[model samples]
Target chain A: AQTVTQSQPEMSVQEAETVTLSCTYDTSESDYYLFWYKQPPSRQMILVIRQEAYKQQNATENRFSVNFQKAAKSFSLKISDSQLGDAAMYFCAYRSGIGGSNFGNEKLTFGTGTRLTIIP
Target chain B: EPEVTQTPSHQVTQMGQEVILRCVPISNHLYFYWYRQILGQKVEFLVSFYNNEISEKSEIFDDQFSVERPDGSNFTLKIRSTKLEDSAMYFCASKGGAGRNQPQHFGDGTRLSIL
Candidate 1:
């Protein structure tokens, strides 16, 4: 079984600054996918960015980027130029790859979320 | 962009009563899933449906829980007998075909309150 861990329960960043949220996972499988989801007060789960385990280069989406260290089993999210809209609960999620035992059924395993607050 | 939509943004039901949450996934999506998150907790996967049958389920998904895609576009999750502990935000998600690196798209969850 794969387990995701977000050590920080709460984080705050000043407006226009950068913030990094840490996440680690334990998985025996070699191929997998990692994702970051944001949940605002509206409670909608919005995709922030994703990283493929096989890719050595990190994934970047505008202001949101990921630092994926496969050997260390760590995937972290970095938000640059943070804005008030970035204030939300962020979750790190994991999913098995195509060849894994649970191939056809790729359900996501999520970590305890970290509530991000943007200070003006 | 295509999106998954769930109905009755909020539901309140008595314990021991049946409750059904409905969702309309993206028109082209082939995989459907149900997940729940207790207040202040992480989102947990419940079940995944493909080809009109359940392909995977979690320990949390017991006999009391059921999923069905009764029609062409609607997917539903039913709780035969709800319990207080079942109160949580139920989310519906869908994804494209297998072997692709597509991310699962989620809907705005339905808050289920069991009294």
Candidate 2:
């Protein structure tokens, strides 16, 4: 069984500042995928970025980047130059590889969440 | 770029009533999926469909729940008898690049409200 944990229940950042949301997971599989999803008040779950366990390189998408420490089982999201639009509930998720059955593929083990608030 | 789309942005129904949430996946996608998000909770995967059949489903997707791709463009989730707990945002997603390893694209989601 896989489990994801988001220690921070809430986070806030001033405009143009940066904020980091923490996440950790428990998985026996050596290969897997880690993802960060954002759910604004609109209620849509949007993918922020993703990182593969085998790849040592951290994933970065514009203002969103991840500090992935595989050995520590830690994958944290960093939002740089944060904007008010970044205010949302962020979740960390894990998925097993396609070739292997995983616990299940489409099923994502998600961290409770870290509600991000952007202050003007 | 293609995107997944779901129908009835919001659905309000009475308990024990049957409700079906629908989605239209990207034209070239192969794997389809359904996930739900209870208010103020994490998004949960319900089932995954591939090759016209269900490849995997979570324990949450019990007998009361069913999924179908009735025709070419539609994938539907039918909850036989809705419960108060079933009220949540239902999301449909699709992934394909000639393989199952592709990153999934999700729909806006249908807000199911049971009162």
Best by DockQ: 1
* Candidate 2 chain B, run of 10 with poorest lDDT: B96-105
RMSD of candidates 1 onward, in order: 1.0, 1.8
Summarize candidate 2's per-residue lDDT along A1-120 as a digit string, tens digits. 889999999999999999999999998888889999898888667899999899999999999999999999999999999999999999999987543443233567789999999999
- Lowest-sum lDDT 10-residue window in model 2 chain A: A97-106
Per-residue lDDT of B76 in model 1: 99
Candidate 2 residues lying further than 4 Å off, grouped into runs, are A98-105, B98-101
> Per-residue alpha-carbon lDDT of model 2 for B2-100, expressed as tens digits?
889899999999999999999999998878889998987878889988888888889999999999999978999999999999999999988875343
DockQ of predicted model 2:
0.46
DockQ of each model vs. true complex? 0.70, 0.46
State the fnat of model 2.
Answer: 0.40
> lDDT score, residue A15, model 1?
100
In candidate 1, list every pair of residues with a backbone clash: none
- List candidate 1 stretches off by more than 4 Å: A99-104
Model 2: lDDT equals 0.88
- Candidate 2 colliding pairs: none
lDDT at residue A21 of model 2 (Cα atoms): 99
Per residue, candidate 1 scores C-alpha lDDT tens digits across B1-115 of 8889999999999999999999999999899999999998889999999998888899999999999999979999999999999999999999887854888999999999999
